[model samples]
Target: MGNFFFVRDYCSISVLPGASLTIGNNVFFNNYSSINCLDNILIGDNSIFGEGVKLYDHNHKYGFNPEFSIDKTDFKTSPIVIGKNCWIGSNTVILKGVNIGDNCVIGAGCVIHKSIPPNTIIKNGQNLIFESLQK
Candidate 1:
């Protein structure tokens, strides 16, 4: 644990034997958030993650092949990077290969599966919208 890093109770951080989870200084994670790191999950400094947020760096390979059963299917791994001073709202799910830039705000219940630019704000409802904070 680094300086000023705080993870609330009941938060689950599962890192595979060969994988890495690098969390920077002053990173705060709320309760009940689950981080499943199979490859790498780099969370930058001063980032705040809300409750029930889920971060996953790998996903089951569910391609068209029916030969392998669901449990036998391999996991496709990727890295997830959240930049400095970002705010991830509650119940948000960040998927594999996502690179979120600095000072970004992710609204509640957002399922992020793509990269976001710097100083961006993402709000999710019936639809998701991206607003740039940079002029």
Candidate 2:
């Protein structure tokens, strides 16, 4: 962490043992944001995040191993990298292994599971098909 601009109240950043959370200079994290770093999470300089944003660097592994079948803590981890000057919108969920490039704008309520290129503007739901379940 290097000269973070501000971290609002009720925001939680948890780094487990042997894991790492790296935040660069002038970064601003809004209220109700959470970052769970089970491996490595690197946020670059001049980045700003909106409210209720969540970032996770690990997820549960779905393989059926008998001994650890009932264990809900069995997880696989990867790193999440957010590049410089990015703006992440409210209620966004950035999952494992997502590398967001510089100067990007991610819209609200987006679940980012893949990498985004530099200087991109990503918005929500242009192809949303809301089918009724009234069969």
Candidate 3:
């Protein structure tokens, strides 16, 4: 938690040992959002996150074995950075190794697995589309 950051009720933020989670100033996280940080998660200032948003910086890694079990799999982690003045809609899931630039808007129910450029708008539908904003 950073300066002037506000997290609403029922939000769960977990920072494991040897992991880092940083939320910048004036960031608002709505209800029922969960953040699971296993590597690094940095949220810039003046960002607004809607309800039921999920952010995970790590995933299970199963080796190339035919009989791979979940309990035997290790975790692979990467960093996630959300830039300033961004708006994330409700029920969105942001995965690892994602860097979202400033002034971006992610639509509701988006499953973001790639980096987003600045001044872009992401619309959620059958397919996610990136639309650039002019000025």
Candidate 4:
């Protein structure tokens, strides 16, 4: 935690044996932002995490019968990789197995899972067709 920039209630995090979270240098995180990387999560440097940004690295597997099985929940692990100099907007949910390239802008209210290419600006309704062009 030396020479790092962070703004949060619990900047230096301490988790149990089963939980994990890793942050890089010059990273900016807003308040109430939570990251649960039970498997493997890696964040690049100079990335901005907006308010209420949630990140998960595991998904529950529910295929067993309710009465016979004693295990209530099962989890599958996936790694989340965020490239350097990225800007994650507010209230965004970054799911597992996502590899975001460098200098990308993740829009607000986005539910992301796919691997986004480098230098791409992903937006909602950025290309809208108002009228048809036909002969």
Total clashing pairs for each candidate: 0, 0, 0, 0
Provide the overall lDDT of each model, using Cα atoms, as 2-decimal numbers: 0.93, 0.94, 0.94, 0.77
lDDT of 3 by residue, 9-118 (tens): 99999999999998999999999999999899999999999999999999987654678556444688999999999999999999999999999999999999999999
Clashing pairs in 3: none
The alpha-carbon root-mean-square deviation between model 2 and the true structure, to one decimal in Å, is 3.3
Task: Give candidate 2's whole-model lDDT.
Answer: 0.94
Q: Which residue runs does candidate 4 get wrong by more than 4 Å?
A: 9-20, 64-72, 125-135
TM-score of 1: 0.87
The alpha-carbon deviation from the true structure for residue 59 of candidate 1, after best TM-score superposition, in angstroms, is 0.5
Please report, as a residue range, the 10-residue window in candidate 2 with the lowest summed lDDT. Answer: 62-71
Arranged by lDDT with the best first, the candidates are 3, 2, 1, 4
TM-score of each: 0.87, 0.88, 0.88, 0.77
44 in model 4: Cα distance from truth in Å? 0.6
Error of 1 at 31 (Å): 1.0
Measured by TM-score, how close is model 4 to the native structure?
0.77
Over 4 Å off, model 1? 66-69, 127-135
RMSD of each: 7.7, 3.3, 7.6, 5.7
Per residue, candidate 4 scores C-alpha lDDT tens digits across 1-135 of 314868776433323366656667898888778787677777888999888888888777655474444334567778888888999988888898899999999987788889998787776545656876886
